[model samples]
Target: MASSDSTASVPDLPSKPPAWANGSPSVRRPAFQWAPYLFLLPTVGLLFLFSLYPMLYGVWMSLRTTDVIHGTSTFVGLNNYLQLFHDPQFGLSVLNTAWYTLTVVPLIVAGSIAIAVFLRDSRPARLLARVGFYVPFVLSPVVVATSWKWLLNEDLGVINGFLKWAGLATIPWLSSDFSARVSVVVATAWNLVGFYMLMVLAGLSQISAEFYEAARIEGATGWHRFWHITLPMLRPTILLVVILATIHATQAFETILLLTDGGPGGATRLVVQNMYQSAFGRLQPGYGVAQAVVLLPVILFVAWLQMRLFKQEGVI
Candidate 1:
């Protein structure tokens, strides 16, 4: 009995770890704890130098009144921000930016999805269409703006030439305030639609073929299938596009700069353009920095709202 009790109390010998396991004696991992960080050092350093430093410096600049020519600055606290509130040009710029965003974002989103859906075919025509639409987006912003500027020029423009050929009066495409805004919108949309379409296409590609097949099997119509299956799955991607479009529209400067140069009036003067004028053109860097700092919050708020909406829809 005693011998049997002693045998029962004996612990089982520890089993050997598999050769693939980290604890296995046969495998030895190099103890270079700092290697991963070292590999990441370049990227982290670049981010700090370019992104973080600029942002911090901008914030610092916004709080001071700096004479760029004299290389002198004096801290004025929130006076610049107060001046922004009272500045009519700044107010107009804010309004213009808001209008631009409201008009362009919906058009881009809808047009992109439609183009993506239409181009999903396996035919050569569809392949060509995809390439044609996507090509404009790859062009440099300056090139795009320059081409469009010549095309929309009042007297010398091809558009006006065509109007004359068709016996229609030459429309002031960029001379009138309303028409200038409209022209900018059209030009901006034409430039960006291709990129938005590609984004939608990527989302479309992720959706399983079986879903569409099953929907068709149930005798679902094309519209029904799109509304029920495609749109639902593409929601996340659409939100992403909207967020990006908002940012682009809000900060739109180059296209407007090249196309209208803030127009016959101040119709196309966006906030960024105003900021640019204050910073470099007017030599009021501190005022420009304040305008930029103001924009940061607006952009963050919009982005946060979009992300919140995306999260609600189960999108990361």
Candidate 2:
């Protein structure tokens, strides 16, 4: 009886084998917690090399007088920044970027929301319309600019040709300060509206359909339903659209570069274009870097303010 009790008290030897027993293939060892961190090592290394290094180097370069010709750089403290402030072109570019943002952001947000609402139905025709609107957003910025350039040509373009045929005077879409600004704003809006529409549409999809059904049964008119349900539910998406559109507008370069070339009189010269011209066109890398560094703070402040707004509204 003592011998039998001793054999039975051996904890059954785990039926087969322990996890750490030799050659125990069926036993799964505990996962190593560091495995995920090891997998992320390459991504972290690349981001440090490419992103963080460039940003830090750019800041350093901004403080120095870089002579690319002689391959020498000298520390210039804040002179580059001070000179940029005194430059009239810099001021004009800031104003143009502000104006562009103010003009395009509102239109893009409102128009996209309206279009998305009108196209929200899953009917075949509405789906097709959504696709048609989104096609422009996927096109390369160069292609979009080139196409608009031809279409908005003062004399030979299809739009002007049609206007002429209808006995309307051909408008110079790229000439004069007002017309140039308008053209850039309209072209930019057309390119970006689809992205905003898709964002808002995604938000609309998240909302339960039962809300609308209940509202209808309770005698809510279309306008009342839209105001009470749609608008409030869409606040987060609208805020996102506004922030992204503002940033893109501030960096408006490719469209204006191809469409206006900062001319008729530098009317549409945005901040990014100004930076390009300063860095490459004028060979003032240090000054250009300084300008970009200035923009960084402003962009950060705006982003922070938006975050504050999001927090206040519990959108975050």
Candidate 3:
């Protein structure tokens, strides 16, 4: 009877509200409620309307062979894609783009990281080197190409003049297939390496200085610090640089066109050049789009892979 009286005296408590009901009055709140989503609505709507809508529309258009304005072309399905595989020019362009990306991506990533590492602690040196590296990036490509074209002229050019003075043969840098390819790589790399160095510099700065100090206290030398702490911490930056360089290199057209026009005879032609030529010069927009569609998956997959592999690099 005493136990029963004690139980009866205890008051019954009201039940807690459900998670989705966190917006109710006199209820416990959720960690984050609809207010956060309301703030995100505009940006989400804009992306959906602009980027995603246009992309899907493009994909739909790729299936049809009509003029974008007139919408005249009939649906051709996979015909555009099939035609690309049979086109020798398209094949060459694909090969060239792949080769260029393979080489330039690694060089830009490694070279930028090296330069940024060396200059990170030295403000004056970093500033001077940054100026030298990035000046060409801001210059118009046409201006750069025209300037270089004059200097690299096969006959009576500054480059040949220097070569002759040094007892080397005056080679046709842009006129031939092999030399033209090399020229494209060199010209593009010169302008782009600085942009990549800036990226690496940002990554280097994000790393805590205390990590280096701790390493030093443990008697770790320069090489040891670089290997144990620096490289591991910079993995995210390395991957970012690789993805960016890949995109740029894979989309490479302007520099090669300005420098080599993809020949001696189709030597330095990249997929983008081929796509541009097909859509504009050859009047085969469908086929060009098809060639481009082939590259889309490659770029996206690589980026996704990097994010997955370097999940803890703390890169935003």
Off by over 4 Å in 3: 1-50, 66-71, 206-221, 303-316
TM-score-best of 1 and 3? 1
Model 1, span 26-139: residue lDDT tens? 658734366567889999999999988999999999999988778999999999999999999999988988898889999899999998898775455455655788788778
Candidate 2 has what TM-score? 0.82
Better of 2 and 3 by TM-score: 2
C-alpha local distance difference test of each model: 0.84, 0.83, 0.77
**Cα-based RMSD of the predictions, in order?**
13.3, 13.3, 13.4
After superposition, which runs of candidate 1 have C-alpha atoms over 4 Å from their true positions? 1-32, 217-219, 301-316
Worst 10 residues of 2 by lDDT: 4-13
Count backbone clashes in candidate 3: 1
When sorted by lDDT, best at the front, the candidate numbers are 1, 2, 3
Model 2 lDDT vs. the true structure?
Answer: 0.83
Cα lDDT tens digits, model 2, 90-198, are 9998998878888899999999899888877755545565568789888887898999999999879999899999999888999988988999999999998988887
* Model 1 worst lDDT run, 10 consecutive residues: 1-10
Task: Tell me the tens digit of each residue's lDDT in model 3 across 1-316.
Answer: 3242111122333345334555676656544567868989999999999977866776776676857567568899988887777889888988888778877877788888898898888877766766787787787778777877887888878999999999999999898877787777877777688888877876787688899999999999999999999899988778778877877776457767887777878889888888889888877677777777787789779878777755554332
Answer with 2 or 3, whichever has the higher lDDT: 2
Candidate 1 global TM-score: 0.83
